[model samples]
Target: MNIGIDIEEIKRFQKLLKDKNFIELVFSRDEIEYCSSKKKNAVQHFAVRFAGKEAVWKAINKSKKLVITDISFKNSVLGKPEVYIKGKKASYIDISFSHNKTTVVAVAVSSK
Candidate 1:
């Protein structure tokens, strides 16, 4: 198994969100919708998901650059985090996220 983790400041993402290109380039449509759904806490949600995609990118250990939008997420019926790659559920990957008022963190373990 391979593991990767990432942490980011929520305020940084709050600033980045002002750029529409950044949002479209990094987040999938579903991700945008889901995060936007949070409304007031949208920045926190986006930051956490950004860290999650970065963790997944590192866990895969790919030398080539990854298309960030290709990595997205959803919540299971039970509210567990689920990773999706290229629009399909990636069963080989397990991911988790956490955040506070100022920061967000994510971890990914790949069993590929």
Candidate 2:
């Protein structure tokens, strides 16, 4: 298994989402919905999704054809974040995310 993580300021993410194109570049409907259900603010959820996308990309590196939207998170019955790939059959993906007053962080793991 390979693991990767990324952390960035909330303000930076807010700026990026201001560009509609950038938002389109990084999020999926499921991810947006799940995150939105967890957090009241859309922008905060977007930041977490952005971090998850970066972490997934970093973990998969050059070996997979996954795009940003190809990675998504949904809530399990336990309300935990579950990560999955859209169109590829891979080993596994695990994601963790957190946010503070100023920053958001995400970590991902993938195995073959």
TM-score of each: 0.93, 0.80
Report lDDT (Cα) of residue 19, candidate 2.
88
Lowest summed lDDT window (length 10), candidate 2? 82-91
Q: Which candidate achieves the best TM-score against the true structure?
A: 1
Residue-level error in angstroms, candidate 1, position 15: 0.6
| CA error at residue 20 for candidate 1, angstroms | 1.1
Which residue ranges in model 1 land beyond 4 Å of their true spot? 63-65
Cα lDDT of model 2 by residue, 5-55, tens digit: 989788886678678777656677666565556555767778877888789
lDDT of 1 at 106: 100
Q: Please give, for residues 1-112, the per-residue lDDT of candidate 1 as tens digits.
A: 8898999999999899999999998998878999999999999999999999999989985743667777899999998889998899998999999999999999999997
Q: Relative to the unseen true structure, what is the C-alpha lDDT of residue 37 in candidate 1, on a scale of 0 to 100?
A: 95
